[model samples]
Each structure stands twice: as C-alpha cells, then as structure tokens.
Target: MPQTEHGANRRRGRDETEEERADRMWTDLIQEVRVAQTGVQILFGFLLTVVFTPKYAELSDTDQTIYIVTVVLGACATGALIGPVSLHRLVSGRRIKAQAVRWASRLTLLGLLLLLATTSAALLLILRVATHDGFVPYLVAGVVAWFLLCWFGLPLWTRHRHTVK
Candidate 1:
C-alpha cells in the first residue's frame, strides 16, 4: 500500500505511488480552481464594464479609487487562479509531476487568498456606492467576517479537528 508518512508507524491515505497521488491531486486541484475561476472571471468582467457606465463619472474620487483598487485585485485573483493550469501545461511530461503538483497547490492557495481579498474589496465598494452611509464600512466588515469564517476559519477548524493522528 502506498501510504503517506505521518509519524513513525502512522501511515495515511490510499495505496498509490507518488505519481498516482500527484495525478489525483492535480485533477482535484483543477476542479477546485475551475469553480473559483468562473466566479472571478464573471466578477472581473462586470467590473470592467462598470468603468464605462455613466454613473462611474458620478462617483467621488475616493470611491473611484476604491473601484480602481478592487478591479486590480480582481485581475490579480484571476491571474493566480489561472496560473495552475498554465503551470501544468508547461510542465507536462517533464517527469516532475510531484514538483508540479506541489507548485500548483501553492498557486491554488494563493489564488484563494487573492479571491478572498478581491471579493471583500468588491463588496466594500458596492456597499459604499449603494448606501453612501457612514455605517457602510461596518456592514462590509460584518459581511467580511462572515466570509472569513465560512471560507477559511471553518475549513481550518475542520482540518484540525478531523484529521486522523
């Protein structure tokens, strides 16, 4: 059985060689990336169109700056999320699938973090534009908190709580 090393005499995972595991991980990572990529791409596409709308000129300079920053963050997130696919394509048949998988995993993680930031920024900007209220920041903060708990906090907690020893 191909088992992952955990501590002494504590093997984990399936009976698969390193290459098989890498292939499986790569497939899993790509599927996960696809979901995130669609969202970021759609959001980025909408954001790009916003600049052309007549209402864009009506935005305060501060809001304009926020919009600009959000767009940039969205662009970066899109790039990171798509990076793993590019990396995989370029490294194909290099006899380095394990290294490729590791790098791809890192890229996917970085992409998720960037997606979190991009979403938060987009929410902040949209709320500010919609409400123009002093409490918009607080509202955005609350939503951000929810996102953090749902997206990151809960996952980490589950990993820590459920992973076998």
Candidate 2:
C-alpha cells in the first residue's frame, strides 16, 4: 500500500474504512447516550412534577428561580442528547453518517455540560431549602468539583497519558 504523509497507514492497526469507523463510533456513542438520557429524562420528569406539588408554593423566590433554571437546563440537555437520533433518522440515506457522527458527538458533549449545570443547580436548590446554611455553597461546589473530576478529568487524563506520540 502507498504511504500517506502522516504515516504508512492512517487506519494503523485497523482494517476499517472511514465510514466503518464512523458506524462503529456512532454505535458506541448511542450506547453511551442511552445511559445519560435515562438519567436526564428521569430527573427532568421529576423536575416537571415538582411545580405541581403543594410544597412548591412555599419555596422562596430565589429557590423558585433556581428550580426554573434547573428545569430549563435539564430540557436543553435532553434535547441535545436526543439530537443524535433525530439527526440520524433525517440523514439516514444521505451518506453522511461520518459527519452526522461528528455532529452528534458535539451535541452529546454539550448535553453533558448542560447536565452538569442542571445537576449542580438542582443540588444547590435542594441544599438551600433543606438546611439554609452558609455552608451550602461550599458543599455544592465540592460536589460539582467531584463530578467534574470524575466525568471529565479522569477521561482527559487517561487520553493524554495513553496518546501515541
């Protein structure tokens, strides 16, 4: 085989073409999204019902605002995470699965970020309503930090550590 500028073979250890790689990636991404979608959908469903509860009328204005923001963020996350399926369906015969996969991956990342914000806001609202303590912000910050570390930091660390030079 002829050598490309980057290397003798861009595919390296694999025998798949770009389309095949995209297909595989799309499958993997869909599987990953299923997990996140379930959690976000459940959380969003719960948030939707919170407003109908009798206790919801008793929350302070600030807490009400937080709840609204959390619900909006959850909605955005749900849309972004589900965007891939819509994209795939609409573009099924367009021969653009590679591009679709890339776009879907971006949407998934955006969804995860939104999920992080939604979760943090929900936590803050809950803690504020539950304890009304000065330490609530600190506690929420700690939990956000933990989520960031676990969700992003570890994957990044491993990617950086194992990347071929």
Candidate 3:
C-alpha cells in the first residue's frame, strides 16, 4: 500500500506500484477521452460546414459573430479533447506517465468547459435566428442551467459525498 503525504493509505484495492497506477489511470482517461473527442469532432465538423452554407450569408451581423465564436470554441474543444493522445504518444516511455495523466486530465476538463460554451453559443444563435423573440435568451439560460447541473454539479456532489476525509 502506498501512503500519502498525510500518512493515509491510498490503495483502492490491490496493491499497485506508481507505474501500475499510472497505467490504469491512463487507460481510464483514454476511454473517457474517446467519447468526448468523438462528440467534439462531429460538432466541429458541422460547424466548419456552416460557413459554406447559403443560409450563413444571410445571417445578421450578431448571429454571424455568434457563429464565429461558436466555431472557434468547437475547434478549441476538439483540440483539447484530442490533446491527451498526442501527449501520450510524445511522452510514452519517458517515465512520466503520472505527470502526463495529470496534464491530460486538465485538458479534458478544459475541453468539456469549452464544449459547453460552444453548445450554448450555437443554441443561442439558432434560437435567435429561428424565433427572433425575447424568450430565446431565457430558453438558452434554462438549458445552460440544466447542462451545468448535469455536467459539473452532479459529478462534484458525488465526488464530495463519496470521498474519505
């Protein structure tokens, strides 16, 4: 069992060396990243095509700006989500899997945040274009709240509830 700096035993179940732990964590992170990467890549691809669409030329200035921001956010999210693979490929056999995993995890989290922003912006622009009503903002805000609750609030609550003191 490996003890933490505070002298708490840290083994999840079976005994694992640092390298073994890193390997397991890396595998898990990769699995999670695959799902996010696929979604972001698809969204980014669709965003890329929107600029070439005939309707894109008719959008108002504000909507065009929102579309640009959404597209940029989607691109950034795609990069961050795919970053872990590049990080692992470049750092493999460097005896730094643990550090690499940490950085990859950070990138994944940032990617998720960017994805959320991209989705929100896309939704806002779509509703504004389709409805042109004041209720668009309210609807967007409600959906954003739902997304926050599902993506961050629930996970944080579960982690805090289950973590040992």
- TM values, all candidates: 0.90, 0.92, 0.91
- Error in Å for residue 106 of model 2: 0.2
lDDT of 2 by residue, 1-165 (tens): 446987665543568999999999999999999999999999999999999999899999999999999999999999999999999999998999999999999999999999999999999999998998899999999999999999999999999998766
Report lDDT (Cα) of residue 108, candidate 3.
96
lDDT of each residue in 109-141, candidate 3, tens digit only: 999999999999989998998998899999999
Ranking by TM-score: 2, 3, 1
Model 1, 29: alpha-carbon shift in Å?
A: 0.4
Cα error, candidate 2, residue 25 (Å)? 0.3
Give the range of the ten consecutive residues with the poorest summed lDDT in model 2: 6-15
lDDT of 3 at 9: 85
Candidate 1 local lDDT, 1-165, one digit each (tens): 334465346445689999999999999989999999999999999999999999999999998998999899889999999999999999999989899989988888888888888888888888888887899889888988898898789999999998876
Number of residue pairs clashing in candidate 2, backbone atoms closer than 3 angstroms, sequence gap of 3 or more or interchain? 0
What lDDT score belongs to each candidate, Candidate 1 first?
A: 0.88, 0.94, 0.94
Extract clashing residue pairs from model 1.
none
